[model samples]
Target: MKNHLKSIVLLVLTSVVIFSCSSDSDSSKSANQFTIEGQSYTLIPDNALLELKMDNHIMDQGQTYDRSSITLSGLNGTTIGTASFDLFYKDGLPVEGTYTITGSLSDNDPDFFDQLLVDNKLCLGWTSSCAVSEAGAPTFLVNANNPTGTVTVINNGNSNYTIQFNGNYRKYDGNFEVIGTSPVVINVTTDVTIQVF
Candidate 1:
């Protein structure tokens, strides 16, 4: 009887441990990670490289849309890269919804967000390999292939946002030649109170 009771208690403890661990896996960004050009990055709640800021509403095509600028960047000693985009909503303030990341940076659609194509020399940095153009700007022979992704924002009802990034960004050269690609998957919970504009 004693041995049987001990076995039952151990089973209960094991079940509790498993349940607790799995319950909050998707609740935050700590469990999510992404890789870019063979460099891996993990999105933590307070990382400097992950940013989501509210911007002023803009008028486009006779309609006003709320805007939010997002930036995700990281470095791995030798190389540094960044992805930037803006979210626009035609309705009132931004709400919890999954928005598509349209590759067009100048898109006039009031209900969609746009991605700003990043130049390899500017956004993807390899200090030693960057070439300066005649305009005194560093230029790269490559750029991203107009990354497409989904941005899912969850408002915690407390001015906090839980954002998720799942997309693909490929490398393309100035001659439109394909070089490489990387899958971007990140999750970040950030406070927008300080970034409200």
Candidate 2:
């Protein structure tokens, strides 16, 4: 009888251990869940690349709409800037190509200086140094001097699209002259589904 009771207790303990291990594994797997049919998807860069939080996308009657705003942030959660795009759609879907979006420096803060940084290196200086030829539609190029890269959008099935930003853009609080050494390279890929009503 003593031996039987010892065996039963051991079996119960083993079952508890197995249940706990499986529960932990399931939770880890569900952390990266992505629903293609869902309206919104979060993009977390694998290697401390740019952190983009996309939300508040509203579609218009003509299918042409404006993304409420795209929040661009640094790996350490610094607000780089907020960009808005005017998307052109045909037959109820956005055209697949490189679409230019108007992005302002420093979230359009009046107190912030107009400068662009790539990999934490000073790319574009103050408004006086790096003047925009067309104030209405300002476009920046990323190279050795400018240092920032470009963003490309690819179309996936079911209203899903992959947004690839191939550069590390940084933001500074003060003037552009205070930029320090060039930080590490950052490339991020994000998948999102746009809702067209």
Candidate 3:
């Protein structure tokens, strides 16, 4: 026997090269296992389920449109701050693909602020008729209910702002709409009053 059949053919070619290197390391670990799946948005910091709705809006009349709907599932677990959002590869297309979750704290300290509106129309078109509506809720001046004259605030420090509806602030000519976004026939009030300073 030629030296025992050449050492049994070099031990069967070293077991077929260790079974082809363990099948190519299991096909590169299933191609790096990437499967995010239709996950448009899931900003799970303190876990706010996330829900922000804005609707057809165009108000500037008697001004009564202070709407809001950021009911992040009623604060799921609660633990989110320093929040800033803007992530899009394609949505109202602003030629974007930006992300900023720079909050380093173990296990990534709850920071996955995701967003993908895909395209509902909104990529900075704020002047041609004014088009850039979304995220609203801030307009409250109170006196009581009037139409007299006593609105003044020359420069409370000059940040450029003087919206007064004196003598009980005639509802301060409200206009902060965004709640259900449309068909609002006026009657908007979340009840606010903070006279002075």
Which portions of model 2 show Cα errors greater than 4 Å? Answer: 1-95, 99-147, 178-197
lDDT of 3 by residue, 1-197 (tens): 99999999999998899987877674353222111111112222333222122332312322212111111111112211111111112223222122222222221122211211222221110100101111242321111121122222122221221221111112222462222211101111111122221
lDDT, residue 22, candidate 2: 82
User: How does model 3 score by TM-score?
Assistant: 0.15
Which stretches of candidate 3 lie above 4 Å from their native place?
A: 6-10, 17-19, 32-197
lDDT per residue as tens, model 2, 24-79: 77434333222111111223444212222224333333232222112222211221
Candidate 2: give the clashing pairs.
none
Best by lDDT: 1
User: Can you give the TM-score per candidate against the true fold?
Assistant: 0.53, 0.30, 0.15
**Model 1 alpha-carbon miss at residue 116, Å:** 16
- What TM-score does candidate 2 get on C-alpha atoms? 0.30
Lowest-scoring 10 consecutive residues by lDDT in candidate 1?
119-128
Cα RMSD, each candidate: 10.3, 14.2, 24.2
Q: Rank the candidates by TM-score, best first.
A: 1, 2, 3
- What is the lDDT for 56 in model 2? 37
